[model samples]
Target chain A: MFNLFLKTMYDKRIFIIAWSIGLAFFAYLMLLFFPAFKDSGLDQLLATLPPELKALKGMIGDISALSTPSGYLAGQFFDIRMPMFISVFSVILAVGLSVKDEEEGYIRTLLALPLSRIKLLFGKLIAIVVICVATTIATVSGLYLGALSVNVNLDWTVVSNLSLVMLLLSICMTTLVYCIGLSTGKRGITMGLGILVGAGSFLLTTFAKSVDWLQPYEKVSLFHYFPAVDIVKNGISIWDVVVLVGITILSILLTIILFRRRDVR
Target chain B: MTIQPVLEVDAVTKYYGSFLAIQDIHFMISKGEVVGLVGLNGAGKTTIINLIMGFLRTSAGKIRLFGEPVLPENAHKMHPKVGFATGDMSLFTNLTGRQYFAFLKRAYKLKDDKKLGELCKQFNPDMDKKIKTLSRGNKQKIALISAFMSGPELVILDEPSSGLDPFMQQKFLELINHEGAKGTTIFMSSHYLKEVADVCSRVLFIRDGKLVKDVSRAELESSHGKAVHITTSRAIRPPAQSSLLGHQKTANGYEMSFIFKDSPIKLQQWLCSISYMLDFTIEDHDLESAFSDLYSKDKSEAKNV
Candidate 1:
């Protein structure tokens, strides 16, 4: 069983390395420009702008805090851009494990071995989760190194905790796509649903901020659970953690059920 | 006392959303038997192989591997004892051929690379080359080497010789014969009748998802009597009332053939009664022509019905 997981990781080593470096570069750039934004008084100018414009730009909360290292990184990078990047990577990796192999005809070879379907499915799922965590670590490491170079004082413990939350959020998104891929075994359906959910949730979460009526429906979106500005300011929420972890577990169970019941071809 | 069959497929039927791919399929393979599943394209040969491998679910009836009902849950138990390869064998494009086999070696948990090395020596595949860069025939060679390297008890191959050159095809046949001699039960499907005729102890002819004929080695080789080509003093046609499978005009006189449901001596004696017959030559019917005749006869009979 571990052999399959190890093979998958090895097969996707290049992808993991590529995505990790790309996200890390993005994180480094976000931290590198922190002082320039604060020193140039753009933070003050942005603070004067209306909330609607900030939300439109995916700032999602107060812009005055853009001068602060944690606020700028979390609000601009983690809250919107980082999560989007990680979620998309996780979904693609997850689908590649579950459905892409089927399309490419590797699943038949795997199934011909003396291993149960549940074991194979679980093995691939575990590999996807490991990849998501590894990418999160990359993002956190880049941010930490970039912050150190800029002489910014950041609470390392808090940064680790935030990274954990990000990892869970990635897990939730990945498993959601995993379930769809396992149930349908069609690359088009899996990719279509993945993009729809990822993009739609971001849109709904942004819209719910100004419109009070959409607030209730925001809970349906995974993005609503991880409010980057709120997380950076007040620390992690027990409810959000529970929701992310719960949804991941639920999605995994649903995936296993569908995979065991559906036909291999 | 009788030994249990290695495989037993009973009245199995399959449907792909109202499209019947196979229906009422039944067969059994005893231990060490070399059986061939013969059919044209779309004849459900692959479907039956998929069903036995537990890739597809049967719509009705039961399949047994070692006398136990074959469900997906229990199918894996037979995997270690069975080796399978299909003509539609696709490989991981990113990995070199060596890496893919190394992965399978781990997946199947073979003791070491002993068998793998031996197979590589036989097939002569460029193990270092990426599969995407290899030709289709080379890919098939890799698949074949993988299937046979493990020395499985039951080897199932679909179109095993497809894309192989004549030399490798002969080598493949020899490999199957060696495996059968070692007491392995082999079930293979192929459209190439001569290939199957060379080694199979029995052949099952499937057409349009039905088992149209079941022929044993004896029946295949000699049941159809010899074809008699006669040369008369003059160009003479066969008597109109003669009983024979088929007759046609040749340059000399006339030639005819029939299934000698009786002895060859009786057939020869009957043919000798032709008054104009001067010289004649008799040859056993070849499987290719025999199968062709069977198919055409079935078509004409269906037309009458």
Candidate 2:
């Protein structure tokens, strides 16, 4: 299982490293030259937004802390950097685990090896976890380095706790993708469903916030489970962490059940 | 003839939803024997391979290797001891042949790199290049090298000769024969009857997903891996003719066809001494021709039924 996990990481080693460095370098440059933009893309975007659009992104205008450099990194890291970077990360992990193998016909090859379907699923699961964990660490590390450069009184505890939160969220989201992959099995359909489920879940949560009746739908939104804003403003949300971690376990159970029953070919 | 089978597929059936992919196939492959599973396209050669590898579900039958039941979980345990290569199983494109072999080594837990190279070179593959960069035949050789690299006890190959050139096809045969010499059982499928005839000790013809022919070496040799058909241009007219009708003299005489048993030497000499230019064409028996004879009746009968 570890061997398969290492190989999968090797497949995306160039991407994880390259993407991490690229995001870090770009974030560092912003801290050095364009501090205002670096610190306030998400905050400024939120402030200028109409009520409906703000609800769509699950945002409320609260940016007094954006004046501080370290506080600014937290906002941009979660909203701007993570949305695009995490989407790309999930895409690569899903493709690596399911789509690429299905395309190459190596799924059948691996199946022919002395590994059970569950074992195979576990291997991909391990790889996906590593990718998600690495990505979250990279984002936190980038902003931490930027904070050091700017010489702000950085909140190490806040950073570490929030980083763990995002890592759990990433895991939950990616495991959801794995379950989708298992059910669909085909590359295009699995990926299309994964993105739709991830982004669509976010969209649903945003919409739920706009309505009083749809408030229950907010609980189902993966975004609803992790409170990035709460983390920056008032420390970690214990309920949010529980909900996110619960979703991760549920998604993994789903992966195991569906993958075990599905036709491998 | 007296030895036990290394692989046994007994009453094995596979269905994809409602469609029966393969039905109750019963066959046993002895050690060191190269068996050719001959079939046309969509004849379920690949399905049988999947069943044997436990990549598929058995509808009503059982696949046993070394006298143990083959289930999904157990398949992997059996797979390490069996090497399989097919046209569909692509080697990693970005990885070189050596790298892919190394992965297989790690996967199968092979320790000796020297033996891996020897197994690869035995199949005439260049290990330094990536698989995508290799030619079609060389890619196949690489696949074969990986499958055989573990020195598995049994090998299952599907349509190995399709992409290979004539020279490479010969090399493929030599490679299979070499593997067989080492007591590895070979279950391979090919369209080329001559190729199967060269090395296969037994020829199994699959028609409409059923094992129609469990032909022995003697039967294949006698039939030349085909059903010999003799067609004559002229008809065989009997000495005593019916006098009930006065018939007009047709330009051509009567003709007859028979299964030609012997070589053309006997038939050709017999034709040359005749006064008339009677045609005595000998048609070679092949999997295609034999299969046509075997199942061509299904079309008309199915319509009536």
Best candidate according to lDDT: 1
Best by DockQ: 1
TM-score per candidate: 0.89, 0.84
Candidate 2 residues A151-249, lDDT tens each? Answer: 656677877776787788778777767667765677787778768766766566545666768887667666665555567778878888888777778
Task: Give candidate 2's fnat, 2 decimals.
Answer: 0.46
Model 1: how far is A208 from its true place, Å? 1.7
Error of 2 at A261 (Å): 4.5
Q: List, residue by residue over B1-305, the lDDT tens digit for candidate 1.
A: 98899999999999988899999999999999999999888999998998898877789989998887876656778888888887778677777989988877877888888888978888898899998999888888898887877778888999989988899898889888988898999999999999998899999988889988888988777644455556665555443323256556677566554444456667667677777776777766567766776566443322100
TM-score of the A chain in candidate 2: the value is 0.81
- Show pairs that collide, candidate 2: A114-B76, B226-B285, B226-B286, B227-B285, B234-B254, B234-B255, B235-B254, B235-B255
Worst 10 residues of 2 chain B by lDDT: B238-247
Model 1, A1-265: lDDT tens per residue? 8988888888899998998898788788878888886677766776677866655544344455777777777777777776677567867787888788888778877777778787887888878888888888888878988888888887676677678788888888988888788777888889998988888787777677667688789888888778777787788999999999998888878766777656677
RMSD to true structure for each model, in Å? 4.5, 5.8
Q: Which stretches of candidate 2 lie over 4 Å from their true place?
A: A25-64, A69-76, A79-84, B1-4, B225-256, B263-280, B283-305
Least accurate stretch of 10 residues (summed lDDT) in model 2 chain A? A56-65
